[model samples]
Target: MTAVVSNSTEYLLGQSLSSRDDDNHNIYTNLLYLDTSSPGFNDPITFPKDPKERENLLELPGNRKVLIAQPAVVTDVGDNIRHYTLDCHGFQYVNHTTKCSKEMFLDETMIKASYYPEVDQLIKDVTGASYVHLFDYAARGPLNGDDGDPKINRPVKSVHCDQSYEGAKRVVMSRLPDKAFAEEVVENRRFQIMNIWRPLEPIYKDPFAVTDARSIPDSDLVALPVIAGDYTEESWAAEPNSAHRWYFKFAQKPDEVLMFKCFDLVRKRMSPVEYFMLRLRTGLKSICPHDKALRSELVWFTVNSSSNQIHDRYL
Candidate 1:
């Protein structure tokens, strides 16, 4: 059952936010969810090292199909898009104009020299993070067809978050070369692992969608093991929930960026280790409507930030 809730400003499925008068700009599509009904669903592992095997495991018997109405970002409305935040919605869309050319993304040197600084500043401006460390960046597009670019990674269609709470902590500790500094940041300071995503071209098909973090309950998130070579890390895959609200911007431009939180460490009474283990996890949702083959190319930057003073600039 689908219900459309509307207001003078916004239109949503379960809740109304804001929308343009001319068009609601909501897209109805099917998003893949974890099939809890599958036999032996207790143990589910994804092999990132082997794409074919992972795809086979994630499809058909393992996937639950659900039709979703994703609300588009109403850019015409005043400050409507800015209302969504990492603390509230787990994702936010911002207008950021980049000086780097499209061709610059293809080269590693060019990307580091031209594009990295832009992303570094963008994260700082958005989050008000005192220290920002950009650890990784990757370009992703269609799997079968490549536009002669070797650096492009395949787009993921599953509904999953990039990191678990434990996984996020591990990333912070591992990425920092100095063990003492890592421990200090993880223990005393508040930190967040965020991803900045921007389309390399105008989005035509397979637009990226993110769930309202408020709509997701702890019960719906299932921690899954992601195996990469010899190492294993935990990530989250969400079970289908009727209450889940998804949103995306149609025909998203290259200048626009989607900033979302993977893990956020806030001040609390619990010990850092215990807190990370016991706290309910929150992550950015990766929802794509795979009606047509996705020809979109996107650049993703994973940035880690701390509330305290700056230590190392880039790691």
Candidate 2:
């Protein structure tokens, strides 16, 4: 299939927001090309087997909306094209009591702390966002990471600190509907992304819905970079060769690539410049009323000691 950006500008703007076709949903879908040779490649791999399977597991109701999702080419992990299972969950230890594990919880803390003035200021003092935007700093993504391979099924553990991270913090915003009808809509798009990961139940014909889609803002979903790994084993260096189940790992092609897939609307929430810089270390200068270089209004940092990686993400 042609790369998403290869399509015409007109096609992009007119692209359907509702989940219907893979072409339309490709925007946010993980880019992992499946390796059919792997066992259970055609079947869904369930571990703890989430009852809901994953929340709002489908599209939401709304008027037609348009967002741009451009394809970006970056250097691969190495020489070989590492194949990865898209959307595998990665967990990390923060405090003795509060262990942050899932993607939903991680996204929530990022949105609360990263978007606030105080946290933004701290980021500014470290990274110069004007030039280099941090796309996904030390924040975690939706359960993405190499836990090993489905062929080996090795259990892993990990511990992390904030200093050894590279990605930037990003704030994601979505106006997708939250009604019963939204489930069907999302499922339609999910099919386009990956039939491997779907809700346990079929779409709810009369599910409850959220009326205010705009209530959730981009800053409400923030994340940072991290050096994550299992303590018992070498998380980054080990090969994923489990016996039967599928786990996160790169293809053996030498170029280790991370596989990811998401819906069209989900793609839009993550592809912006401002959202990219929230996680990097940038240098910030106190605003001078007369300075015209400030891209936004001068806002003071709000100190938030309540914030900690206890619930932060580093995927």
Candidate 3:
């Protein structure tokens, strides 16, 4: 994707990337990429399960910053972005309006009761899956020290995919009550682990960006270990590549939904890893005069076309 550079000005951290013409189609920003210069850098970095320990390692010097030019996503091209399927581009955008109230996002009980069903139906509609199970959801906000809510987490800054194929299988087994059924599904049934992301309010900072899966090669993927208590899981992180093409919806609204595939059992030709990174790109400086934080929410759904009755133990 080629971007028309309207201005030659350089951008620093926390600065605006918009041009003077107010181009809504592209933004230049810095994104974190894995640093492969260190010896044995591909070796898994163990992240402690404890939040305090994890926070200490958040700013580890293992990552390198790269200036990335992400084009604004054009939703009106053809079929309302349906051409960019999970199988093709690893991500899709849909103009879906939700019935859940904003207050429902604040409480876990309300989120499970109201928002979960909404997400389930949305996933079923988009994927045409016989069954859609929402496993987890996270409400993320800016890195404010005094939020006081444990449910709200700081937005992730690095370029990474959520799960690896083996990690996804473990998640399936952990969520299913019947061990036999879980094994069967993992071995035979084709499934996908997808993330549905939406902004709770209009996005002005920290815009979410995803790279076209076709642009990424398998050689760039590096498996990183995540230690959670007694269990450990692997996720994919990528080294910087010049061929990568990034896209994001400028000033994404609450009604817009970005659905991306994290792991797809059927699309084995292309790697199941879906690559994405979020950057703190300040929107049009004139409109966003005040530097307020941004808030968004994401839900993970396990989708399958199976009609079999398997008991699910939601985690």
Candidate 4:
């Protein structure tokens, strides 16, 4: 497949907002793709089930971007086989509990002080990461616009990848100030870059959607270096392509959780840099859209807190 950069220009005049304007009543569709050459990318792997990988040796590092995905399934995503290799699929829907009030998630302090442990355990339970150190959390994605709704956290409608392999390590390092302890933990065990997304209220207007890692070609991903507040990191963005498939469930209730992987030790790791670009959904919105008194944004990184595994940093 030939990967082509959709436009010669990479800048945009206005920021695009995310909405259900492109929904079709069918709630499903198959997207087409015309491939071309992408600057830098390689070592594409299949997901959780098939650990096989296809490499493009022509692609180089320091300027590479790759995409990963998992196809849609109506069955419950919580019952996954842990013994299988997670190379083919990059995302999953797990049933989890936040144990925090809607208000607590909205407040950063309340989340760290009271709800951090629950998330810590969730990561441990699912990924088998004996010890997790959470360096940061965001009340990402605006959940609602109702009276008390904190709408500042609007969703980034543009498709872009933020967490890179190095960024994932930085996240771990940020949590563990003791460099020696961090090295010991990561070296001994595998860690994953995962995120937890849920709705605070019954969702209404704009809901979240993700591209299946399967939809993206390894060459199609463009990596770029990012300067976050305190650290410089690497991230991913997809150049526009039709072959890319995007999916979202109808009316994801508050009880369900969307768990997706970004980078993992088990997968091929590469260092690359490219600007962010992604295939945007172009179509119609759903016919039976619900009313949104408000939408609640519930999301955070998952990790475990095991003091014995490393040093006594928590102490």
Candidate 5:
């Protein structure tokens, strides 16, 4: 753990007025639902992968109306995962079992790492997960200041949860395919959208911030429609509430992973960017704030375990 640098973006929890161009660079505090009938939506969203595109990545044409605000208390969170998120649900952090090799990120042998089994074993050791699936692996870089390069994915600075209830159900159905198996899995197994997120290098500027789910009531979550590539997914946007609590372990390192729940079976269960560093009121910060790029790798998959066991022996 090196010295961590801290920064803040004024996120917009309420709706004012924004434009399509501000989508990637700006995060809206208000919940903006999807209007798929809008023009060019059916058209392929292909474009030159340039600075402008990355900055406005979240932008889409749609009809959205602002909703009422919710009430709550806001608290600053500590770096301990077990205290804030794991036992609390929604998110958790843990130390890696071994040293990190940067080469694994670039090889892209479909993410064929020698220690992959070891990694899964580590995940099982912590979560008591019987089936740990590695579905996707991606590398994200940090906010690219003038010196920032576009080739790398940036460390997301936006405050948002990745999945909605509908999206989770859709994923389960697509993965399982068999109605009987899917139903049985959904009925008997514990499902979680878990991500093993860690920086490939040391993080100081713009460390990841995860809001405590317990602090947020269901009313504050808005289901916003997001269209990327060929798919449209519904994602939850946290409407800025004064009571929303935010936590982060500053200067996050390569040997540590943020195992977070984008959506879990427990509301019953549920589910960045800078201005290219701020645009929204509750998540606002700057247009560009870095002179270099940040490297990070996140491998996420849903795990199903018939039994819930805590493997704290190694810890």
Candidate 6:
């Protein structure tokens, strides 16, 4: 019998946020719950009974249906972990935002100038990428949880305290703040930023990959091949003569596992200017310190840049 393989996002939803088992049994530290009014939800679908057959893509869990069901409703997410449910039709904005911020080690600031270098160094330590992508914002209300054209997920500003670095304040939005006369017009921008605006569609493609298969049952190794196809083929795309490719040198070992860590720079979604700005942040030596109020403004500025860039390409 084939064991059921869960998507990363779904697996993450099921994780017990406090379990401290071995690497094979660690639990998440957070939980995400969806409001009952969400159109993107439905009864949980059980896995196939077969033990040997790999799960089909459609049969695997996702949030597609939740959005389809409540195309234009406000999605409410509670902070408590026990109330969280992994069973749903489509992914929720609250879920994605919570996950991304957590993954990036970001608080509300999204771009905490003080911790910018530390964030980069951490990523560099792990990924060995000297540079990391960062953005600043003034205010991110739209993405936070504002309701709008039911169909639109406006960007929302998250808040985080800058540790010790000094820089600009709040993120800014170029256009008018969401005029949410009604829930439909509230605009789900935060969802767009967290869910969309990514080089990859549904950035949470397998939100549960690291937490679930790896930390859950020991049987995930058998399911790796199943989850492998869930990722875009572009993840493995190689272009010769391209500046994006990173060649690695590996030492031969009798039985050691040689892991090749490479960044697949395909599907770049940033504008050249945005890319340059990202590069500039790493080299900037002159730093400007701002209070929470001012930092809030800077956050808005970065959000405006992100929104403008996303609109240029998508809207």
Q: Write the per-residue lDDT of candidate 4 for residues 186-278, one digit (tens) a residue.
A: 554445555555667654334444555666666765555654445656555555555554444455666556555665554123435432322
TM-score of every model versus the real structure: 0.71, 0.18, 0.73, 0.58, 0.64, 0.20
Instruction: Tell me which of candidates 1 and 6 scores higher on lDDT.
Output: 1
Show where candidate 4 strays beyond 4 Å. 1-88, 141-151, 185-188, 267-315
lDDT of each: 0.56, 0.18, 0.55, 0.42, 0.46, 0.19
Give the higher-TM-score candidate: 4 or 5: 5
lDDT (Cα) of model 4: 0.42
Model 3: weakest 10-residue lDDT segment is 281-290
Q: Which residue pairs of candidate 3 clash?
A: 25-72
lDDT of 3 by residue, 53-78 (tens): 65555354432223243223222222
Q: Which whole-number lDDT from 0 to 100 does residue 251 have in model 4?
A: 55
Candidate 3 TM-score, C-alpha based: 0.73
RMSD of each: 7.9, 22.9, 8.8, 13.8, 11.2, 21.7
Instruction: Write the residue-wise lDDT of candidate 6 on 1-315 in tens digits.
Output: 000111122322112222223432222222221233454343332224353332242456632222111111111122322222111111111111111332232244434644455433332332233223344322212222234322222221110112101111111121224334212211221111111111111211111110110111211111101122222111110111111111100111111111111111112237754321211111000001111111111211112112111111111
Stretches of candidate 3 above 4 Å error? 1-14, 17-23, 39-83, 143-148, 267-296, 301-315
Q: Give the C-alpha miss distance for residue 246 in model 2, angstroms.
A: 24
Pick the TM-score winner: 3
Q: Rank all candidate structures by their lDDT, best first, as comma-separated numbers.
A: 1, 3, 5, 4, 6, 2
For model 6, the superposed segments whose C-alpha errors exceed 4 Å read 1-111, 136-263, 266-315
lDDT of 5 at 63: 22
At residue 16, candidate 2 shows an lDDT of 22
What candidate 2 gets wrong by more than 4 Å, as runs, is: 1-33, 47-110, 113-177, 180-261, 265-315
